[model samples]
Target chain A: MRALSRETTALTLLLAPVTLFLAIFFLIPLGIMAVYSLLEPGLYGGVEWSFYHWNYGRILGWADGFIEEFDIVYLQVLGRSMGLAALTVISTLLICFPVAFWISRLPAKQKNFFIFLITLPFFTSMIVRLYAWVLILRDSGFANQLLEWLGLISEPLDLMFTGTAVIIGMVYIFIPFMFLPIYSSIEKLDMSLVQASQDLGASPFTTFRRIVLPSVMPGVIAGCILVFIPSLGNFVVPDLLGGARVVMIGNLVEQQFLYARNWPFGAALSMVIIAVMMLLMAVYLFRVVKADSNR
Target chain B: MNRSLGKTLLTGYGWLFFLFLYAPVALIVIYSFNANPINVMTWKGFTWDWYVGLFGGATTVSESSLYVDSTDQLLDALLTSLKVAFSATVIATVMGTCAALAMARYRFRFKGFYQALLFVPMVMPDIVLGIALLIFFVGAGISLGSTSIVIGHCTFLTSYVFIVVSARLAGMNPLVEAASADLGANEWVTFRRITLPLILPGVIGGALLSFIISMDDLVITYFISGVDSTTLPVYILSMIRRGIKPEINAIATLMLLFSIAIAAAGIYFKSRNTAQ
Candidate 1:
């Protein structure tokens, strides 16, 4: 009984601050948002508790009040967001793989220098880094100037306010994130297995296909999830580089709060996005947990 | 021969990727020295005027040369940003370290739930968290501005600090603390002498990272920041909204170099400690 009391005391003391912090900030706030999402916006953008409406339903449905014509705008933005995220993941993988391989292959004495160089860029603020992209992609930027000097184009191309520029910004921001995971995974991998496979008459390509890929698949997946999720919900990158032409779910949420001044509708939209993210997290956790158990 | 060719190609592409990553930063730093702002493409001549101009009359300038002229009030915003980020890092570090220690040392019920809950702030979209906080503040009739921004930053920054310190804590052997306790040291003494010294690197590293994230943040800052409370990034955005400026390139270059220098020192110390 004394031991039980001691354990309870320890547990209570240990958990008190964390619980209080989360309750006041994270949980209560989220709960308020949930309730607010269901409430109707008042005449002056204040909450009107009694006049509840499913105006949020209209966000994902057509103006004609028909459920079947479900708002195509949300679906279109979702599709575009997913596509951009997919491209970013592929590009990150392609770039990070060779870099990771090279770093892993380097002698331990020189490896720190290589890692330092890669991480140097990461120490800078991300906004500063993205702003550099603006300078690079501008009509008078270096990219156009180089092309013009090389006679590749007679005039500067409009690269600044395009979907392509958004992708460029995303890839630039996420490359380090992808690289760190893959690099760590590659570093942890035992190299002797590959050598043994070669000794067994396995070709280099076959060895890489069968062994190297599987060994680092977790890193790839982690990298993909990290890059993909952030980019999908990204508002700043799309807004700044995509020139207000491209809109992601994040921008939609921002508009709901600022421009539209519809709190409940914004809350509903945020809730939907959160639900989607939670679903993705559940699926990922299931796979990871299952894989760990198998291992 | 084919294998060699493949290796060469791979290595070439790797270099190309490096160029892609570094080129923009390099260009920005170079252009900060430009004598003229009208022709952004060419180097009319090298000048130290921008650097001199940045520090000399930052307060009196009609507008920042970096962004639109409308952002003349951006210096005050930058100062507010520094103040908020520094305070957030300190508060979060202390809170995070305590939480990390408690989680690491004591095994208890709902441990998994607590951990998952703690990590939610890190992964949830900024928009969700930001708007939620805004709603909560408004519901409570609290005014939105610097206080809200600091609270919002601390919410996520604390979790990040906790994660970093917890990773370090897990790697640490408990025997040292046990030994200190056996030597008649009290709990606080044991912690201060044994655990704190060992985890200081992780604490500093996490604090540095939090500082960077807080400085760079936009999404949450945008939601909660008032007209009077513009962060540097928000200021830059408003500047960009009006139009581009040559001074922005200068600002970017300076911020980049400052961070790099700090990171280099941090990494050097960390690697040196590990070597010992």
Candidate 2:
């Protein structure tokens, strides 16, 4: 009895705090946020205790003839966020394809150095990085001043506070997230397989399409999902670089809780974002499971 | 000749890719020493005046630029960040390491359930996580402050530490522990003399990484932070909302250097563990 009690005590001491802390802070909060989404947004702030689907209805554009007639405003922001995420993923893959291949081809010593250089920026804060673009892209900024000096354009272009600027910032931020995974798969790639394919008389483009592309598709998909997920919820980039002219789901959530003080509505917006993420995760999980079962 | 052509093409593409990656950071370093304090692009003259102005409270051009975020407040925010990072790192490291060890060394009931639940923090969007935590705190009647920020941080950070430490544990051979037990050592004794020393690298690496993440955090901290508990990143976000200033560039440059050093140290420790 004493030994059994002691073993239980040891296990409890080791695991209980983490379990309890997560339950209280993580699980409980997620549950509450979900619950709040189902409740009405109070007149001023806080929430109404009565059960309400109106918050979700407004965000999802299925508002049940309640006060507002199916506002598409929030839906547009969600679409914008999704569009930006898709663009960031595509652009990153295009830029990274050549780089990933090149890095994998490097001599062992140089390979580590190049990988380090790529990932070093990722360790820094996103806010600071986005601010750097502000310096470069702002009117009277570096690009404009240089163009003026070279007589490239008569007037400084309206570069900042635009959708183009937001995409540029997000792609810059996300490229590494795309690069490293693809590089990992590329590094581990068997060069002999490609050489064999070539010996079998396949052209370079054909070899890439039939062999190299198929092999690294997993990493490519992984990178896309990684970039897409964060960029979708990315509040900082659109808020700082894109300015008020651009409002994504992240910004709308921020306005609700921080600016508008509408907790219920904020919770609803959060649910929509979570739903999109969960849908993506379900697809990702399905793929992983299918691949594992096939193997 | 075809091979050479390919090599040159690749080299050119590689340089552009690297330049794209480092351009933003490189510009910050250059503009921190820029002459024009407000407009970071236009160079009036080279001066260490921003560096001076940061400490002594004066700009390169004028005494009162009005929009220059107070360096004193920035420093205060830095301290708050340091304090929060220190607390969250310590707590998360202990809980996460313990969980890592338990999950690795022992078989227990409900292990699969615990495993899935732990990773919820990593995959969940920060925006959703932040709002959820905020609503949670309000619902629970816990006043928002440094404590809330630390809680929010710990929620995610513990999982990160768990991952790092668990990777270390996974690679480690279980026979060492079996050998220690065969010599008549108790569980505590074996863990202390054998297991703990082996996994110390993971613990240290996880601690360092968690500290950096806690500091780098903005979205979670922003929602949970009170006026008195504004972290450096949160402060920077607010400053940018107001307007651009060169002092921010200077501070950002310093933070970049600081994070690189810490991350380099963490990688070193992580690599050292894998080598063994």
* Root-mean-square deviation of every model: 2.7, 1.9
lDDT of 2 at B103: 86
After aligning candidate 2 to the native by TM-score, how far in Å is the CA of B10 from where it should be? 1.6
Model 1: residues with Cα > 4 Å off, grouped in runs: A1-14, A50-56, A62-70, B58-72
TM-score of each: 0.93, 0.96
Interface RMSD of 1: 1.7
Give the Å error, residue B210, model 1.
Answer: 1.4
Q: Which TM-score value belongs to model 2?
A: 0.96
- C-alpha positional error of residue B49 in candidate 1 after TM-score superposition, expressed in Å: 2.4
Which pairs clash (backbone N, Cα, C closer than 3 Å) in model 2?
Answer: none
Native contacts conserved, per model:
0.62, 0.78
**Candidates' DockQ values?**
0.64, 0.77
**Candidate 2 chain B: worst 10 consecutive residues by lDDT?**
B60-69
- Model 1's alpha-carbon lDDT is 0.80
Candidate 1 docking DockQ = 0.64
